[model samples]
Target: MTAVKIIKVLGTSAESWEDAANEAVARANDTIDDIRGVEVEDWTAEVENGAVTEYKATVEVAFPVREGNP
Candidate 1:
């Protein structure tokens, strides 16, 4: 049978939430292959001086299970 594996990843950026999410996938790509999709699970931020200094995203990344891996 074929299956997909899902994992969680966190990404942060100073630009925007979208950037943060993209960063998660980009970083995950470094170690994972055949990335099928991603789901944004949560959003958070770091604030300084009454402004958002950083944006953080919790992402669920999906990829096919390797042939020999469980």
Candidate 2:
């Protein structure tokens, strides 16, 4: 049998929500391997002077569970 793990991370970007999510995954890739998928759990943004200053994405990252480890 195969198994996987899921974790949540918040990514922020001055670009766009999609970029925010990409940031999260890219960061996760720094240490974690075998990244299976990503799910955008939520969306948010920061506004300043009536203009959107930043975009935020709450993402769930998934990766496989190795044998003899969790």
Candidate 3:
């Protein structure tokens, strides 16, 4: 049987929410392998002077679990 694992991560962008989500996956790939998918959990923003200064995204990243190895 194939096994999978999920991890949560936060990503930020000065542009848009979509960019934040993509950033999450990109950063995860830097340290993780076999990335399968990503689920956006939540989104938030930082406001400065009544304007959005940054976008934040909470994402759940999935990857295959290595079997018979530690």
The full ranking of all candidates by lDDT, starting with the best, is: 1, 3, 2
Candidate 1 structure lDDT: 0.97
- The lDDT of each candidate is 0.97, 0.94, 0.96
Q: Estimate each model's TM-score.
A: 0.92, 0.91, 0.93
User: Which candidate comes out best when scored by TM-score?
Assistant: 3
lDDT digits (tens) for residues 1-70 of candidate 3: 7799999999999999999999999999999999998899999999999999999999999999997877
The per-residue C-alpha lDDT of model 1 at residue 67 equals: 88
What is the total number of backbone clashes in candidate 3?
A: 0
For candidate 2, write residues 1-70 as lDDT tens digits: 7799999989999999999999999999898899999999999999999999999999999999888756
Off by over 4 Å in 3: none
- Tell me the tens digit of each residue's lDDT in model 1 across 42-67: 99999999999999999999999888
**Deviating ranges (above 4 Å) for candidate 1:** none
Candidate that beats the other on TM-score, 1 or 2, i.e. the better one: 1
Winner on lDDT between 1 and 3 is 1
| Candidate 1 worst ten-residue window by lDDT | 61-70
Which regions in candidate 2 have their CA more than 4 angstroms from the true location? Answer: none
